[model samples]
Target chain A: MQKRISIFIFLLVHIASINAQEAKMASIKEGSFVPLYGASSKKPTVVKSFFLDVYPVTNEDFLNFIKKNPSYSKSKIKGIFADKSYLAYWKNNFDFGSANPKSPVTSVSWFAAKKYCECQGKRLPTMEEWEYAAMADEKRIDARTKTEFNTYILSWYEKSKTYENTIGSTFKNYWGVYDLHGLVWEWTSDFNSIFLSGESRKDKNNDKNLFCGSASVNATDLMDYAAFMRYAFRGSLKANYSTRNLGFRCASTTKY
Target chain B: MKKITLAILIILSMQSCKDNTQNKNVTKEKPISDLSIYNLPSQWTNQDGKNIELKSLKGNVLVMVMIYTSCKAACPRLVADMRSIESKLKPETKKNIKLILVSIDPETDTPQRLKSFAIENKMNQEPWIFLRSTEENTREFAAVLAVNYKKITPIDFSHSNIISVFNPEGELIYQQEGLGVNNDETVNKINQEAEKIR
Candidate 1:
């Protein structure tokens, strides 16, 4: 009887654990996705998924990063890090005594932005992922009518404001991601890489060599025709360059 | 036996859930497309110093080229290429399409300088505009359009010599590379792209 009771208790415990595990998995599986525009179609031909940031990284968040990683601090930085644009606004505007630490950190270089995400055990979203998230919802499509999106995007270039309050202070995108297209231009991990040429949808075999130059003749030929021009454009930007409009967000793979 | 069965079922359910979660996190990837070069950043000043934004050019098709007044090598050829294309357009098509030359050298390419550059190129026409912006704004704008440029020295610059075409709605429709190419072929391509928007 004692043995039987022990076995029964064990079974009950295992069942509860299993149920909990199942619930966790379900939540992760329900990840959000945004779609990309096709050549001939107005609607997205492909869907790209990403994380939903409740808010942009605040000044406090960046300060914490600096505290943890001394290398990124003003003193330890070198070479491209020495550019005036790197910390011009942030250093001048930030008031340690009065500034809101929770505000999103601005005036950071693309390299620094990447390092910040790495410290947090997260990664920046790729440009494709960023665009997909921005245009996720059908309902939001009407809002982003050519006129409105153009106007909104252009306005940022015209006006010159030093600091914004925080990330969520502005409008949110379709996937509930805040300040994607507006508040600041977030940095992406693959923003500067030359993407593998070729149609993303048709190439199902996932050829790694296509990314490099040494792929098979067939693959190279396929890539030359299928690759988009935007990839080439991204490759043009030098890493040392920094601008006021640039900022970043973090993403982590869902641990199962 | 009943307890054993229950335990096995729960474990299997848990494993299935984990797999589903992993699947959900995996985002769908897609190929990027060739975006129009004209869909660049906004609020650029024309050669005449008028504030021009992409939206403001909504009614007419636009042909865009990048130049700096200080450039001695490519700017002349680029302007000549644009003129050659303009000459080939039909009277009605010419009336509909606007030619724009944006200055990558914002610091030195002032309104007066841009105007003189246009005059020297004999591009003093209805649609031609020489544009300039602040250093910060221009760099951001250049990045958006993927127009690579660097100060080879203080006075001279090296930049990608590409011309962009925009539709009436300000979407980047097409791009032509380099200054000198098959002029007739280029003109035909431009006219064909312009007609789509018209």
Candidate 2:
């Protein structure tokens, strides 16, 4: 009888773990919208229906990742993949220090975030797809026109130490995804594609000397100040750069 | 018997999960510095239809630019800039440098296409290499170089015209930006890095 009980317990634990290993992903339906900048000025970039992580990749999740791939750990990571501050907030190479393990992992470079997604059979969201999903509020799909939506994002910009909060702490949006705002700035796969030079002089006029095809890419909505800030921030980022407030989540083409 | 089967099944699944993150591609080598581009593991096919890793050019100063074969604008000027930089270098210094043109449109710029472009442009010689890789790897490479590019149409891509110079250690030493721009400074930087190779 004890032998049978032990077998049952093992089976139960195994099944439970299998379920836990599978991260939850929210299904975002196919949609089309004109981004502030995209493939073109007039044509709306069409985003296919895909599964996005319901929450940002957490410290607990990243710890598990480093356990499997030690090369990505703080000490072991290559300088080509990240800068000196990669995981600087962590107490040690393996420990998250005073950080909440349930909180989204920050101070991760685009390369590190990208590898994390790829290891899980997923990929980082493109800027178009990320903006498409993030434009939503609690009810509407395209919420940039909503005054409150813009205000909420702008207010979060003013808030400090928001990265300390755990994933899913913020209000879930229309697609049931949380922490797109009021948590941390996330890395997109093609963050380097932005043309707006971060230097005040270059930002004043779209400098032709700095960009090869700057004229081809333009802002469809100059009024979206919140998104403009996001674009400018992305424009300034190099893939190897890691910072305290920046984090990322994974997205998959296939539904899980 | 069922108990044994269950245990084996559990072990197999766990093993596969571990397999996902195993260092399958990395091989034993002299410990690469964190800042070296040699740490990148992407593969490429050269103009000669040869599969090569970036590490193969490890000890040579790399002067690299991105271009597409079909491009009518900027690429010619960029190629001219590379050639001019090459001409300005002392023959001794030139021998230690590899002028590489990486194709942004890998689909159209196959090894054969690159070879023809090399021959037509009179660069099909020693110290001049043309390479193309998978679209994903190319994008990652561009990100490392901080070169912004986007496919504007089916045939055209708008890419930054920046020539990056890497030392024999695969560490970026200098960058010359803009098309048809004076490359005197860039040439001097390249010579300075190449001089260290001896």
Q: Which number leads on lDDT?
A: 2
Query: How far in Å is the alpha carbon of B159 misplaced in model 1?
Result: 0.5
Residue by residue across B1-198, what tens digits does model 1's lDDT show?
677678767755553112111233324532111232222334678777888765456657888877788767777777777888888987756767889888878889988888887787787768677778876456555544445555534576656566777666555566666556556766676677666655
Best by TM-score: 2
Please give, as one word, the docking class of candidate 1.
incorrect
lDDT of 1: 0.55
Quote the positional error of residue B116 for candidate 2 in Å: 2.7
Task: Please give, as one word, the docking class of candidate 2.
Answer: acceptable
lDDT of 2 by residue, A1-256 (tens): 7877787788778666545656789999999998887566568788999989999999999988887678889998888889999999888878999899899899999988988887676889888889999999999999999999999999999999999998999989999999999999999988877777553322332446556666777888888999999988988888989998999999988975
Write model 1 residue lDDT over A19-64, tens digit each, in one string.
Answer: 4322111111123332221112222234234353446666777765
